[model samples]
Target: MRRLIASTFASLDGILQAPGGPQEDPTGGFALGGWMFPYADDSMDLSAAGFDGKDRELLLGRRTYQIFEAHWPYQAHDDPIAQSLNAAKKHVASRTLSTLHWNNSTLLQGDVVAAVTALKSTPGPDLQMIGSGNLIQTLQAAALIDEYNVWTFPVVLGRGKRLFDEGATPSALRLVQSRVSTSGVVMSTYVPGGDVQPGSFVTTEPSERELDRRKKMANGTW
Candidate 1:
């Protein structure tokens, strides 16, 4: 079976919204856009190249789809990353958009979770999700993601939409790979490690005598 990989670019404080421009996503009064621009370097390029090399189909949310539709198609034919993105089969998870402008794009209809699950079971290349925060949250909550490629930048935005929000379905993951870029970006790959194992604290409960002794010590009655 093909894996479903979810990738995200996040700030140190975990904000994943609009790393491109101020107009990209100003929701919740987020003013800091293009926050990840300064750290662009060879390592970033290499990371993009690595993603392009995955030989996977593309899965995206509406916002991410719109962003790519506006830019990647205009890139030169010789650009490897752009070519890969433009040529790959794209499935967009959107409830409102009735039509897609990008080539090889398909609108995911019906229940989002059901649609994605059906895709996961189909015979084809792995599905890769890039820069789709809202979609990522849904896939995560459904426990459908098989792997996560997190490229965590060094700076913190302090506020914005995060990659992983609260109330997500509890699950565990194992770090399978890690690397550090020259600009302090940490790239980590994680795979699903199944359900979280519940464990109790190792320390024993304080005895009554021990508690009384501590109380006496505090009261100077030791």
Candidate 2:
């Protein structure tokens, strides 16, 4: 069985949109594109996360695939990042795109969840999903991702697409590894733990004040 890993760059506010460049994604008039550039430093080597010396495949959403297809192919073959991306097979999850022109790329068949599940069952290298927010949300909803390599930059985008938006299914995750780059990027790896265990800080039974507050909340009273 192959492990499905999702790697993404998020802001302090959990916004995952347009970290690369201004033209990358400007939908909804997102003026804060390329918010991650200022934090870049020599210590930031993403290959350490999962990009090097691994048997992996690329799983991408349509927009991300388009972004990569336009860029990675033009990079020099000697570049480690470019080499890995160029040589690895890519699977695209896009309902609207009927065809993919990128080399070594194939469009996923049938439902995204079912297809990805079947892919995981086959004997192969781990599947790495990169910068595909929409696809990531779908896979996350289905609980299909096995690992998450997240790099949280220091900045925050007040409004943009987010990593765990409202309505995302709740699940638990255990941090297996973590590191901080010189630029203050928090790089962490996590694996799905299980269902979210609920607990509370209230030590004893609810006091009359708390109970009344709960009642008011339930009744939608201010």
TM-scores for the candidates: 0.87, 0.95
lDDT of 1 by residue, 48-156 (tens): 4246624789999999999889988999999988988898999999989999999999999899999999999999998999889999999899989999988899998
Give Cα-based local distance difference scores for all models. 0.87, 0.89
What residue pairs clash in candidate 1, if any at all? none
TM-score of 1: 0.87
What's model 2's overall lDDT?
0.89
Strongest candidate by TM-score:
2
User: Which residue ranges in model 1 land beyond 4 Å of their true spot?
Assistant: 45-50, 198-202, 207-222
Best by lDDT: 2
